[model samples]
Target: MKTIDQTQQEIVEEFSMFSDWMDKYEYIIDMGKNLEQLPDDFKKDEFLIPGCQSRVWLVPEFRDDKVFFKTDSDAIITKGIACLIVRIFNGRTKEEISKSKLFFIEKIGLVQNLSPTRANGLASMVDKIYRYVK
Candidate 1:
């Protein structure tokens, strides 16, 4: 997986190459397609995230000083968004993660496009991750 800075830069650069919003949307959907599928059991209520329109569940685990996460969502796009967060935060120490800013979502131009509920869900998910880091 790429580092947060690398992923952010890559997404920004990629979007910069697009001539239109249609192309950008296509790229985002493609990115969603590349996310790893979550297991059926991980979608259970114990892991469920409450704010999303789609069902989202996230489980955090720590190993060898690194944080690892498992997540699933009923919506494909949301799942991909969760995957992006996992890629950014996983394998980092709690302090490192807490101190870092998640600017990649903005770099990918997601904040402006997502619905209010979805955007709130994203924020909730990030808050959950930070809570674990603390």
Candidate 2:
């Protein structure tokens, strides 16, 4: 299994292959398309993330000192972005996730390229992940 940083680097390289933001968006949308569906039971209000324009449900499981996240979003772009986060941080130890920085977001210019609402939503998604890992 890859470390979180290694997974992030892989994602950055993947995004770097895209020449334009539109292509990157398409890539993200495709990633979202491949995300595993969250069970209807997991999509309850208690798991809902705040400060998002769309409904996002995030659930974390801890087993044998590793954390695994299961998440879903109502919007396609948001789902895609969540898929990226889940891919990076899943199956990591709490120690590994505690001080992690999602540098890929900035390295890929995702923070600047996203609309303010989507960016805030992304931040909220990440914040929730950190909170869960803690």
Candidate 3:
């Protein structure tokens, strides 16, 4: 499996291919559309992430010493954001997840391009992931 940094760098390279933010946003929406659906049973309020402009749910499972994540969001862009995150951190070891800096978010200029509320939601998502790691 690719190291977290390798995966992040791959994403950065992919984002660099976009000519503009609108294209990037479209790519993100496409990614979200391709994300595997989280089960209805995992969509409970307890799994809901706080501080999001849209409702986001995260469900984590540990198997064979790796953590796997399932996420869903009410907003397309937010779901896309979750897709990026889940693609990176899911199925990774706790040690790998804990040590990751997730530089791809900034490297892709995703955080800067987001609305303030969405940025907060992103932070909340990161926090929720870390909480699960612990």
Candidate 4:
């Protein structure tokens, strides 16, 4: 799997090539398609992400100074969002994640698009990652 840094650079490069939000959104959705599906048991309440419109689960593991994340969501769009995060934070060290300028909503181009609740959920997801990183 590609590291978060690599994914971020790729995203930025991709965005640089595109001149519109629609292209960015399409790229994001394409990235989401590649995310591996989460196991049924992994999507339980204990793994549920708060503040999200759909059920989302992110299971993180630490190894060799890097974080590995596996995520899944009940909503297709949210699943895409989760995938975006995993692609941007997975396989990164705590320091790397901490320094990351993920811009969860902005990078995904959700700044003025997603509902207020979904935006909150996006924030919650990033918070969850930071919490685990610590």
**Top lDDT prediction, candidate number:** 3
Per-model TM-score on C-alpha atoms? 0.82, 0.91, 0.92, 0.78
What is the lDDT for 28 in model 1? Answer: 59
lDDT per model vs. reference? 0.75, 0.84, 0.85, 0.74
Worst 10 residues of 2 by lDDT: 112-121
State model 3's lDDT: 0.85
Tens digit of per-residue lDDT, candidate 4, span 81-119: 777677788778898888767644565456653444654
The residue ranges of model 4 lying beyond 4 angstroms of the native Cα positions read 1-6, 104-108, 113-120
For candidate 4, the per-residue lDDT at 75 reads 71
Instruction: Write model 1 residue lDDT over 37-69, tens digit each, in one string.
Output: 778867678778777777778898889998989
For candidate 4, the lDDT comes to 0.74
Ranking by lDDT: 3, 2, 1, 4
> lDDT tens string, model 3, 1-134?
89989999999999999979999999999998988888899999998988887888988889999998889987888899888888999789988888888789888988653344654577878877887887
Name the candidate that leads on TM-score. Answer: 3
Off by over 4 Å in 3: 113-119
Root mean square deviation (Cα) for candidate 2: 2.0
lDDT, model 2, position 106:
87
Q: Which of the two candidates, 2 or 3, achieves a greater lDDT against the reference?
A: 3
